[model samples]
Target chain A: MIKNQFYVISLLVILSMILVACSGGDAGGTSESSGGSESEAVTLKFFHKWPEPEHMEFYEFAVQEYEKNHPNVTIEMEAVADEPYKDKIRVLMAANEVPDVYFSWAGEFSWKFARAGQALDITDAVMNTDWKDQVILSAVEPYKLDGKIYGVPMRINAKFMVYNKAMFEEYGISEPATWDEFLTACSTLKENGVVPLAFGDEFPWAASHYVGDFNAKLVGGDVRSADYLLTAPAEKLFTDPGYVEGLARFQTLVTAGCFNEGPNGISHSSARSSFIAGKAGMIYIELEEFVTVADGMGQDAFGFFQFPSGSGDEGDQKLLTGAPDGFMISASTEHPEEAMDFLKFITGPEMGKEYVKRLGIPSAAVGAVNDETALPIVVKGVESINTASGMALWLDTDINIKIVEVYLPGMQAILNGTKTPEELMQEVHDAAVQAQSELSQ
Target chain B: MKRKFLNQLTPYYFLLPSLILMSVFIYLPVVENFYYSLFRWSAIDTTLNYIGFENYTRIFTDDLVGLSLFNNTLYAVISVIFQVFIALVLAAMLEAHLVRPFFGTLFRNILFLPSVLAISVVGVTWQLIYRPDTGLINQVLRAVGLDTLTRTWLGEEGTAIYSIIAVSQWQWVGYCMILFIVAIQAIPEELFESARIDGANAVQQFFRITVPLVRETTLVMTTITVIGAFKVFDIIWVMTAGGPNHASEVLGNYLYRVAFRNDEMGYAAALATLLFVITFLLTFIQLWLGRTGKEN
Candidate 1:
């Protein structure tokens, strides 16, 4: 009798454990299926890549305000840092645990997810609604693929040559408008014992930005797009000599002692620190970082210029290196209506103005980042992005990732002086060919 | 007969939970990994194209695979030299009473300090220490007027792998030494005393007794070091990210890059399968050699 009681008790314990293990998910499902009434109480899972305290402050405020307004909805939020977020999102998608709303770059990065049917098609919701008029059209353009929008742009970002004005004036250097003048300025800075450019290829994306900018100016937009989309024929695919010339120009910057030593060893933040401390003359920085620069070096100390154009006119010199980063609703969300509502609220004009004021990023929402809400430099940056002929999306995101894999490391090798421009281009050409084949498949 | 059967079944009943967990977690995924390896798939997409050993063929021909394998081999060999062999000598010295009592504990604690640190922390700390301009190593070299000897420790192709391997040694050698120390402590002191009385010196007794007695521990440590070397990912990932053009790429890092970064799930599955085979074969060989040595 005692032994039988013990067995019965053990079985009961195991059953209870299993029940406890499964209860949380079951409760969520039950709540989800209860009703779509106003008091139904929906839980939306939100994921984003900004976990930094500064960004988090804005995000937390936005979430709280949204939740307060919609008492029936609750947001379960999760955030990861930028780099790990890229890997983590894929894992989550693979595990079928994608959050209802998430952050994504508005390029091949988000396009891949959209192509895989993992992202919701928000085209009708964005275009048919008043949201279309609220955002800058240019910023919203990148989110369109195959004539449908998959994401809503939140911020407009672009790269610029931000310099310490005091140091530049101390060395009698002015903003360069041409490649030759830029090189001369670098030489002058080097002679003055200041690092002309604070370049860090540790992440390699920093180098890719330069190459992307150069390629845009040298290779032209249409040809580059043809190559990027792998729509060009085999003979013309990434075989442009201008591609080699673009890499060669970057190599010239390296050979001219235009950057800090062992750039491949340094992190971008460390390089930014050197620039902020007046140890480096200038850095190619994104507009989003202008606020951080202002905070570090006082609002009046720094000035910005577009990356100087080379003498070549093969490409549109007015093309700026940048794209909008935005948010997407997952296709698998159980609460699509609620998820879309939250995305609209978070990316709307009010939150966008708050984004600029609090987080210091230029908002994609039209007229959200005036002088009152943003720093003077940020206002100028937004104007530049607005007036540019077109935005050159980041190389790492704009191009096919397989090709990016080659371009990034190949650029690092150029920084390391281990591979020549011709050699690197050959590798890039081969990768483009492979990408073309994969596209056909 | 019923009681006997019940007694016999009790051990299996006790093991049932663990066995089920292992099947669900470890064994199931491994089988699924092999099945997925034969198909071209992406993690985000629900499409799977049956590609039948094409990924395996690609792995054999891939230059990155060859480079990663070479790096893994280099790591294993170096780890064996430092963590296994050198740690054994250090453990033997500690057990031989060469140091005073107070300092012995101090030294052991100092040696084991790094192993307790998180791998991410260690990788980050070493990255700061290996910076070309402001890093500790370079700063020290410049301070002593040995600037020529200073190099980008974790940046350049020539130095990145070696620098990462050195950090691995710094973190793991102590742990391996502790294992050796424990094994050495378990040996009878009377054996050493008898050797001493038989006209054997410290070196002679160490070779004849301590070394022989700790053979099993040495085998275990060597196998662990080798497997750990092959499985290295966090340090390399956090530090160089298998760069200045993949100078420090290993199998695990390459697998992760292909799977998550490139979204090539099938190819990554193949790479994972290859990694498992390599580790399994090496462990089998080591254990087989150990058994043969015991038999002899």
Candidate 2:
């Protein structure tokens, strides 16, 4: 009798363990969705790229606020760094499995997902919102396709030549307006034991900024948009003399000792840290990075200037190099209403103010930033965006990802002096021609 | 008759799970890779253009492939030499009476520690050590006033590939040593004793006895290490990203960049297939050489 009782007890214990495991696995099911009183307990995935230590609190706050507002919805959040996120998003889309809401770059990046039937069409939902006009329409224009909305604008940025005010003052160098003056400043800075520019090319896109800036100055904006957008035929591909001239001028900067050693091996974050440490005289920074940088380098230390045209046509000086980064919902989301509502709440003016205040993101929502609470550098950033004649989309953003693969490493080749201007441009032109042929096929 | 039949089928039941997993994860992907390599596959859509054999033809014409193959071959040769020959020397040192048994175990564990580390950690640590401006190597060179010797270790085209190769050597040489130590320990005590009794010196005993006896282990270690050197990705990816204008582009990271960065999945698949064939052939050759030598 005793042996039989022991056997029965052991069997009961194993059954209990399996029962617990099954129950734990079923928590994500819609058990709480009877009679449509409070809708199904849906777990909405929120994925994004800002996984830095400081940005964690901002994301947690946003998710917690959304969950509190919608008790029936549970927000499952994930974040990755920028480069990994770029690769991960492609793999996710290729597999036909996407998060409910994810951060995406506008233009060809979002269009790839949209073309793949992975992006959600939020045209009607966006029209229903009251804050539609508050978003800078031009900022969100890149994400629009066929008169349909695919993303909500989360940030606006314009590139600037960010310099340490104290370093420039110590060197007695004002902002250089011409190429000669820029070289003079670089030489002076080097003489004083400071790196002239903290150039980092690890992302390679970061290196392409100079290429874009130089190309903007040399070839007119129309020519740039035509070739860089990869719309031109093989005969009219990136063979423009101005394109080669722009690259040669970039080589001029490298030869002039303007950049620190080993630019291609460094990362943008490390370069930024070096700039903040006053090891470098200047770095090219985006508007969104101003506040964090100012906080690190002290508010009175850093200053920014417009990208110098370097004795080129004055007409191209006003063109801003930037892109609209925004939040887009995927087609796989069951809770479209809840997701849109949450995005509206985040991008709305009230949350926009807090977003700008806390994270220092360059908010696209009107009244998100002001002269009072904003850093002085941010005030200048806002003014730069407001007064810009026209925005020139970043080449990596405007062009297809295929061409970016060529352009980025080509820039690296140019910087490293491994490939000449002619060689690099020929490679880029060939890549563009190949891509055009493929798309036509 | 029923009992005998059931007994024969019992071992297969135990192997079914592993066989199923290997087919699903490894064999299935490889077959799919081969199938996909024949088409012009786009990530945006499933519309594939079946331009048969064009992709393989392109691989032959591609200059990057030539460079990568040369690099991989060089890497395999060096890795085999270091991992097999050098590891035997170190293992013999520990095997002999010069070191205490307790010290031998300690040395073995210490040598194997780097292989236990995550690749990312190892790559980043090496980068810090190799950095031009604020690196330990450059700092030491400067301190000794040999500042001219402190050229960018990974920035210049000539040195970048070799520097990365040196790092791989540092990481795996010790791992191969452990395998050697294990094999050397397993050699019987009587052979060395008998050789010594015959008036053989330490050098003679090592070359005649220990060297020939551990030949099998050398084959195994060389096979593993050579294959490893061919598939190296993380260190190159993290350290230089095949940069300084593709100076350090290895086969593994090159295929990855082509696949994800260029969005040419078909071409990338073809590259992967070529790499697979190359590695497979190299391993087959190693095994063949081992068998021939053993027969001799």
Per-residue lDDT tens digits for candidate 1, residues A1-441, read 576466657667766776787897888667655646567888888999999998988999999999999998999899999889989999998888888999998788888888889899998888898978888877777888898899998898999999989988998999999999999999999998888999878888999999999899998678988998888997788888788989999999889999898898899999999899988999999999988889899989999999985566688889999999899999888888889999999888999999999978998888899988999889989899889999989989888888988889889889878899999988888889988887678
- What digit string (tens of lDDT, one per residue) describes model 1 on residues B1-296? 77677667666666766786798789999999999999988778858999999999999889999999999999999999999999988887777755636477787888989999999999988888988888999999999999899997877888989999999999999999999989988998899778888999878877999889998888888888899889989999989999988889999999999999888999999999999999998899888978987896
DockQ of predicted candidate 2: 0.32
After TM-score superposition, what is the CA distance of residue A346 in candidate 1 from its true location, in Å? 1.3
Candidate 2 clashes between residue pairs 3 or more apart in a chain or in different chains = none
lDDT of 2 by residue, A188-250 (tens): 999998999988775578877777777777787676667866677688888888788878888
Q: Score the docking of each candidate (DockQ).
A: 0.65, 0.32
In angstroms, give how far residue B104 of model 1 lies from its true place: 1.2
Q: lDDT of each model, Cα atoms only? A: 0.89, 0.79
DockQ of model 1 vs. true complex: 0.65
lDDT of 2 at A97: 57
C-alpha lDDT of residue B191 in model 1: 90
In candidate 1 chain B, where is summed lDDT lowest over 10 consecutive residues? B95-104
